[model samples]
Target: MSADRGLWITLEGGDGTGKTTQAVLLAEWLRDGGREVLRTREPGGSEVGVLIRDIVLHHRGDVAPRAEALLYAADRAHHVATVVRPALERGDVVIQDRYLDSSVAYQGAGRILDPVEVRELSLWAAEGALPDLTVLLDLDPAEARCRLDSADKPFDRLEAEREEFHARVRDAFLGLAAAEPERFLVVDAAQDPESIASAVRERVAALLG
Candidate 1:
């Protein structure tokens, strides 16, 4: 990547972990600093991705583990190509929700597939593009469940999964962060939103510098 290339930041965590909230805060912060920002998400970042998102998140049918991985990979491929890369090329900071890490956590560990294989597939799909920074909102699964329950909204397929599955996903996320410490900023999601946002901003400011 060029030194002048715009930053690519991905926020990752299990459902109700406040990835969306942090993404928004980061985007607003970047914009306040006079930076161009592109906010996007996987499985729905592009037009093609919208259709795939429906199938993967709302089909209400059994999807084989490998098949599910492939669907996510497909969305990642198109999203990075048509949405993410162009924003970076234009020197716009891209704050994305759920990148390949989610697949490695959800499909790989949660569904009992090989995390390494899932990561390799995603790398191939995105032509080896990795985020400049990945913010992981670490939270207990039970706390996340309680938050989701309080929302009283419909659960997407992933959110509706059992607690054990979510536990696996959280562990996988922590493992990924440990393996790539330089690229990850893990925060306690149980913190007040302002505190979490402050931590994220501090790390992001360093990158911007």
Candidate 2:
């Protein structure tokens, strides 16, 4: 809430947890309130990030855990420098789909890497930028899998991971929220879209004030 900067909000959760749906609703609501909102996501928020995203998410070949982590950090470094920071400096609300927390959860906990080292690498990559508010949409891995099956979309690398991996990711996200209560809003993704959006809006409204 610095005088020269607008808010930074991020939506985070496992696949099929409706982060996109809620991001859309939140962006629309912010726009309706006469705010300039920039909707973006990690690993594809910049042109460089798009290439990294394809390799990390779509390549059929195996990526070593440390290599994957480095790729994410590369994307984050370029993305924050070229895309996210400018929007915030211009006083635009940045509603991002994912951020460093995703790296910590997926690469660290899910992939059995050191979470602290992963976080440190991420912080170093983005020059220590953190979202002003992070909305974590929590859901069970089994239920999330069902939703993904119903969507009929091809599984990406991470989504194709075993349920146990996703469960670890979920627990990691919750732990992060618990550690940073003021910066995080943990929502039940099983709720209806409207209900979830309402909860998000309530939190965002308080921040805007």
- Clashing pairs for model 1 are none
Q: What local lDDT does model 1 show for residue 157?
A: 91
Candidates in order have lDDT scores of 0.94, 0.94
Worst 10 residues of 2 by lDDT: 1-10
Model 1 lDDT tens row, 1-209: 22465999999999999998898888888888888989999989999999999999999998899999999999999999999999999998999999999999999999999999999999999999999999999999999999999999999999999999999999999999999999999999999999999999998888878
RMSD of candidates 1 onward, in order = 1.8, 1.5
Instruction: Estimate TM-scores for all models.
Output: 0.97, 0.97
Q: Count the backbone clashes (under 3 Å) in each candidate.
A: 0, 0
* lDDT (10s digit) by residue, model 2, range 1-209: 22345999999999999999999999999888888999999889999999999999999999999999999999999999998999998999999999999999999999999999999999999999999999999999999999999999899999999989999999999999999999999999999999999999999988888
Q: Give, for candidate 1, the lowest lDDT window spanning 10 residues.
A: 1-10
Instruction: Please give the lDDT score for candidate 1.
Output: 0.94
TM-score, structure 1 vs. true:
0.97
